[model samples]
Target: MVMRTLAASLLSIGVIVTSMQVSAANEPIQPIKPVKPENAELVELGKMLFFDPRLSKSGFISCNSCHNLSMGGTDNIKTSIGHKWQQGPINAPTVLNASMNLAQFWDGRAKDLKEQAGGPIANPGEMASTHDMAVKVIKSIPQYQAQFDKAFGSKEVDIDRVTTAIAAFEETLVTPDSRFDKWLEGDKDALTKEELEGYKLFKSSGCTKCHNGPVVGGNSFEKMGVYKPYKTDNPAVGRMEVTGKEDDRFVFKVPTLRNVELTYPYFHDGGAASLEEAVEIMGKLQVNREFNKEEIANIVAFLKTLTGKQPDFKLPILPPSNNSTPKPQPFE
Candidate 1:
């Protein structure tokens, strides 16, 4: 009887260990922690700059032009429209939760949000403005100068400080408390049966291999077509242009699935117009499997659960330019 009791206790301990392992395997993606900016003054200043088209050579295209907050942090177009209506090569990725990305841009070129902030301003096709000109425009505005002095403890308004303030504002662009986050927090009822099954299928089909993270992606760079080639007419060569490595061709930063439903026209080229089509294509190209209509729908449902609370803030009224301010060269 004593021997039998000891054996039973050992079996019970083994069962508990196995159960714990299964529970751990069920949760791979973590929840996002919403971060607020420590420097409220800097964030407010950045907000003005973000919405101020004066930063652009055309004095029309602002950071909000491509990354519209009302439209899920993207322009919702296949490609962005730039200065003089020059078409952008690749789709504009959403800025929501962008600070969580390993690197900025589809090619993972920019090291951080601050570095990424300067790219479009100088890109001839985008803002069509130089750093020196951008500083001059801001400095000329007396109201802006006062704000800069208060925010930075200096009246100086250089590109570095400008981008730093913008990055600070962007750092607070996180969307937390989604249904998926609730599920991750041990709320079993947060997700439906169908959604749960879809998540299981997603893991079993190896979709989570690349898309597993707090952001459900954006943690690393991955080839657009791992199992097969992705066809696109877009001329951008992905990471190859940055790394100059033949193997880096077609390797782009994996975008986050958070608020994906709102950021339609999927992929770098924005070839897949619908979420269903994007899921089907990803399954075929990345997993080498063709998902049925039901599977696709279920997966899309799971993806929708990633939508979180959007940022809430009042629109900033930009300071008007004075006589010293350089006139915008919209036509020039």
Candidate 2:
């Protein structure tokens, strides 16, 4: 009689678990849309510029140097390696799915990808090249001029055109069709039991307040330490620099969870060496809760499901510099 009663209870539990899985299709997190470029030639031109190191004063660093497509669109370092090997102030954010971000940079300085693409090249600590120099170098190359004419209907090379092409290529970097996305699309077997539970906890534990939406986090800005203070040796004032407002201090754009499994070490300071540590730190500081080892593991498993199909394209072959091309000053 006791064995029969135990079997009945187990059967009842199974039904409840199945119901929960079905209901998960109604969750707010949306799937990423696959990219379809409107202008293939323009995108190809942008791809060439993205891979060309001639944009930098040293002719050694390209957009791919920091935001490597092979490594989840980030350099995967504590901070980026800059011109003269200078250390960057903050960790490099992933370029993948970046077009979905409300604003660019940790501080949300640039309004769009086009604006953001121009920043690093002119920054003294980064590529260390003036916009004029970059344009001059590109304009001097006859092959690039022909390609630009094909792309824009004009052979005039300028900073605006350069940045516009780069932005066009970056827009194609969106990733879609992750396991979590498959689950969201009503595939019951897409996520395991633990991942579903983790998703429930992720929403219930107040993580969804900031981490919701299509990209799972890039839509808003939040304080790094809402419940407590965040300690970091890296001295970034966050949005305060952009707004000149005291209240905006320590407030930063919440990074996207998409492909986060590959974009590490985590956080703006890149202090958390592993996803488990990052999750624990966020729970205590951002949500004012502590997660145990099992919970952390489950949450991380769910987070890993955010990894999707990365962009696939052939490596671009940059046009060679002509005799009139300005020389890059590596030391100056």
Q: How big is the positional error of residue 122 in model 2, measured in Å on the Cα after superposition?
A: 0.4
How high is the CA lDDT of each candidate model?
0.90, 0.91
State the lDDT of candidate 2 residue by residue for 206-251, as single tens digits: 9989887888989998888999999999899898989999999999
lDDT by residue for model 1 over 285-314, one digit each (tens)?
A: 999989999999899989889899897999
Give candidate 1 regions above 4 Å deviation.
Answer: 1-26
Error of 1 at 153 (Å): 1.0
Off by over 4 Å in 2: 1-25
